[model samples]
Target: MKTILPFFPLNLVAFPGQELNLHVFEPRYKELVRDCVANESNFAIPSYVKNKIEYGTEMKLVNIAKEYSDGRFDIETKAINVLHVLNMQNPYKEKLYAAGDVEILTNVDNGDIILKEALFESLTELYKLVEIQKVPLNTDFRVFDIAHQIGLSKDAEYDLLQLREERQRQRFLLDHLKVILPQLRDIQKSKELIKMNGHFRHYDPLEF
Candidate 1:
């Protein structure tokens, strides 16, 4: 099914089940948020990359955290689905913000059980290396659900959003882990060395 959605172009990529809190101040976006809230509507956040808007995610407004006297708003939203841009309109129908007619993409979950377990372990190790503790994810959590929390770049996350199969995304994640683990370990080792530099280590006097 196709639909015309209120569009919010952002530099960040949002994944399904991901919660995003935003500060809405721009006049156009302020109107956008106000309208969505009043109508109980959903919006699309397209990833703006390299001067072009590409794939995006659909998010439902969860709540308005606060509303300022100047009409600015702070909102909390959760991504509901992914979308592929079919076409777009600027200042859609004389509204302040842009609008896009997008096709909702299919989200498939066909990951290999073994590969999924490995991905989970790798993510855990990565978080540990960075010294950040993540909450226990639900049993139904898919890899895509945590891709952003696991430290994928904006570009990488956007790329991942385009994948239609779970196994393909899993493979991409596995490869990313393989490349990132060593780099993270190297960083951790450097931090350790830096901390130890000032410590007193007994050294043997060389025969001069």
Candidate 2:
């Protein structure tokens, strides 16, 4: 469905189900936050990449964490869904911040079981290689839950957001990890070799 929402253009991509805590300081966005809280409405975080706003994630205010004396406040939010911008309105009809008409993208989790399993294996290896102590997998684990830590570039993340199917996203991420694992292994080997540079080593003599 298509609807209009207050647009907060950010440099980072907001993944589905991601939690964000924002410090509302700018007058325009401050106004937006107040409006959202008052109306109990959700807002859009349009990814501002390449000096343009296109796709983003929809979010709802969880609470106003703190209110500073200078009209600035900290707010927590959870991403609800993905959004594709139809049009943008700066000032949003007299408000300082921008707003947009967006088409909400429903996430499809019809991923192949095998694909998920494979993806999970790759994810596990990736976590091990990166030394991430905690794996955030829940009952229904997904790529969005760990996208931020998997070495994806901003552009790659944007592309991931554009995909609606869970399986497609899984494949994309799996391929990404596959490409990275070899490089990581190579780097690890290089590190190991480098560490041996100034150390004494024992050699086994072969008997003829």
Ten residues in a row with the worst lDDT in model 2?
A: 131-140
Candidate 1, which segments miss by more than 4 Å at Cα?
133-140, 190-208
Q: Each model's TM-score?
A: 0.86, 0.92
- Residue-wise lDDT of candidate 2 within 58-160, one digit each (tens)? 9989989999999999999999999999999887898999997999988898878898888878777777777778875543688788788788999899999
Q: Which one is best on TM-score?
A: 2
TM-score of candidate 2 to 2 decimals: 0.92
Residue pairs with clashing backbones, model 1: none
Give the winner by lDDT.
Answer: 2
Candidate 1 residue 137 Cα shift, in angstroms, is: 4.7
Task: Report clash pairs, candidate 2.
Answer: none
